[model samples]
Target: MPRSIDRHELWFGSKLNPRRNSLNLIRLVLALAVLVHHCWPLMGLGGGPEFAGEWLGGWAVAGFFSISGYLITGSRLNNRLGDYLVHRVARIMPAFLTCLLFMVVVIAPLGYLAAKGTLSGYLSTTTTPLNYLFSNMFLKMQYADISGGPYGVPYPGAWNGSLWSLYYEFVCYLIIAALGLFALIRKSPWPITIAFVASVLVQANIEKVSVFLGQNYDFVLLMRLLPFFLGGSVLFLWRHRVGLHWIPGILAILSSLIIMSAFPGWGGPACGALVAYALLWISSWLPSPEFVHRNDISYGVYIYAFPVQQLLAVYGLHHFGLAAYMTLSAGITIGLALASWFFVEQPIMKRVRKGKSDSGAPRNESKSSLPEETNGIEKQGSITATTQVN
Candidate 1:
């Protein structure tokens, strides 16, 4: 007598274990894509590079949010609010604060003095202190002020333009935590699902909302990015039922592209959902080598990239050529990012984890736990697909 295996079981069993996937590399690539996209504008090319202009950077950032959505939703589901906050802080703050300080004390001071030709003038600019305080707080306290840099730089006033996304990322985290806490109390996904649908719809209609409200810059950006974040959450909530097959994944992406081309703003949510599905599909079905998991420098890379680009612009490297500027900036950026991982971020995170263990707090499942559907089929030791989204 032969036993019949559940079709879903066979399907997932044939796929790579989620825990062992190369999400770190995926994030790193996305981050680099953003850096490369910026090269077009930063290099004085007169306009955005074909294919890498506004479209690529925004898409990469959206992809980052999608990954964050899935992993952060998983984080909220499996851990206590306090523990989750602790983990999020450990992942984000140390590297972020360090980068912010570098921008304030080193980059800003140097750029200001170089451009303005007087320390007193640089010191008198209130924007300097404001940038430090507000930007470090994720812009909740103050808006970023980019007051100094070489005049020739493409974006002289903006120190770390890439940082704006961090504020949104933090907001998304809060949103997920709020919904997750409510779901815990209610023991239902309906509320969260409804919120997700509403958010997506709002995003789809963002252009109309912008026009009706006279196009507030912050409002428009938030609406544009929110759909992808919500899509990620939806994928997490419905992970068990979502088709992981490549055929469906491909079709969804193509369909979204067609709809987006046809309907632009109205198709926003559909595009976001398809993007999230494609990202998750790649992460789940394709595993990376064990060695690739050892170091996660994506956060460092992301935080450090803009400063490097700005520095390049100050030095007139942008006049050289796009390839030369990108290569030089990326090289230095990667070096700093690796150093941040090895010296700053990794050590702080390790200490934070140890402190939590020493305090004897009830531990959540490892951040990498497999989804509910795969439980018991694989060894309990297998890692979950969710990686560090930040």
Candidate 2:
């Protein structure tokens, strides 16, 4: 097996989290998956007719949601309602704005030049320079005038098609936060969690029935994402309670998968219920040394990838062949990832977090020191948790 480590304890949602290395690793892998998906077309080799590979790669987005769910759910619950907004803004905006500026200043101009037949094929352009600039400059909620919602791929020639996922992700954050706020008011978590599952089903139904359903899917998969976030809180509360024997946990995981497969289309509750336990197994069973905790580079990959592959395709590297294209693309992407980690992510996040720590002791307190309490979440951060985004 590929070397596995357990950093679930260190993820962003945890109260005393230094960092979320395991989830970051997962994010990094998902970013690579994004790169490959985009790169494949540029390489001129289709993803091929393999169900598992397609499913796996397509599922990477699901993994992204899962990780976000894990981190944010605990974050929403643990923080002071008022301060949650500030933390969310600080955590998201700096990196997001940085990346957005980069796209407009650097990538869009490159796009423009290519569009006007001035620059060579590190990209190909079927759209006008204005459209190219528009897509890269503003995160369009509806691409090319189609109601594919914001999440679906827009007119391909426009820059940064992948950003559409951010739209859904942000939307997911709102749903969770609102649900979370209601939970706080009612003094209960289960109601909102239950509502979330119902919401996903409603979403799927609206899709099947109404042609107006712009975005729809079995978002029940998203519930699993929440576990990563909530599990961190759970770990903080009950780490001593967890034991490291994997057999029962593994069986439970197997059972969940079996249920998912058998139903293929049913209640999302089963998935939601297992999320906490599934992540628990990841944290306890794995060895600590293997769980290399560190600075995050994954966010950079997430922001930069679409433009990278699209640029490569414009270069006509596909004319050379898939293998050569992938190699070159990976090399370029790695360099970008390293640069993003060093310059954009690490410096900014560190500074913001430090500023918060320096501003006197945290006033917002939780019954326990889980994510809900540690950062002193303000209301603004809660609503705009994922909104001040890249």
Candidate 3:
């Protein structure tokens, strides 16, 4: 007979060691999955790999949100409001803005030259590079094309389709920040639990809700995405009670698959908790390389991959066959991702950390450090933590 597992041994909270976890590796894989998924459509090969009626990119993005929800919630509970907001912005914005500028100055010119055979009118076009940059500076993509170039691409005009999700991700960050204002979120999981359940219900009945609320994409996307994020938040809040055992993890994955098989449309929302739990469980034991543990390039991969693929398509590189195209795109994207991480993301984050240290903040009060208190309770003056994950 199999030995019975001890309750304390199975607890996810006890097993969660930030320094040793494979979350960064998992996130990078998911980012690469998104790149692969987009490869199909950008190459005019039809929709990418699908499971449970959703594309691989969609599932990968869901995974991103789930992980973010867990880590970001922990961040909020462990920091002052100002510090939380600063970290969130710093984590997301710098490289994002740089990507937009790079697209305009470098990618757009190359695309315009390929399409128009000249760069004379590129700067003076209706959808100018300046317009693209300014419009999407806030993470909301208003203009997807620059100088009306990228004409020959399979998925023409759109510079970066992957960026749409960033707006929603930031919104989720703000939501956590708002919720953290109340001590209840730090004390009990009920607030996020109820929110998660409510989001699921809204998604299940989204058509009717859209009828009542007047057909908004923002609302629909939030309803679709929030539950997964909240599911992660719920897991973090109740980590002590939740087990990270393989048996339970396998069960959750199977349950999600069954639900998806049965209900194609709303199955994802219904399986949010299962997905979150399975992801966390997998992260708990998955082995990660030292490089990934030290440098997280997942965000860079995600933010840069779509545009890289689009540029390839713009140059008619998709005609080179899927394998060749994917190989080239992955190479370029990974290179850019590394630059973004080491040059942009990591440096900026380091400055943020340095600023905090220079301000005389206590060492234990860093971004990811948990307080001495445990089990969802916050003690007085224990207002910071160490090493926040995005």
When 1 and 3 are scored with TM-score, the better candidate is 3
Candidate 1 vs candidate 2, lDDT winner: 1
Ranked by lDDT, the better of candidates 1 and 3 is 3
Deviation in Å, model 2, residue 123 alpha carbon: 16
- The digit string of per-residue lDDT tens for model 1 on 152-269 reads 5777666677888877788788777777677452365456567767776777677776787798876777777777877777766666556556666678778867776676655645
Candidate 3 minimal-lDDT segment of 10 residues: 370-379
- In order of appearance, the predictions have TM-scores of 0.83, 0.67, 0.91
Clash statistics: count for each candidate: 5, 29, 9
Question: Residue 156 of candidate 1: its Cα lDDT?
Answer: 62
Query: When superposed on Cα atoms, how far off is each prediction in RMSD?
Result: 5.3, 8.3, 5.0
Model 3 TM-score relative to the real fold: 0.91
Cα deviation of 251, candidate 1, in Å = 2.0
Q: Supply the global lDDT for candidate 1.
A: 0.66
Best to worst by lDDT, what's the order?
Answer: 3, 1, 2
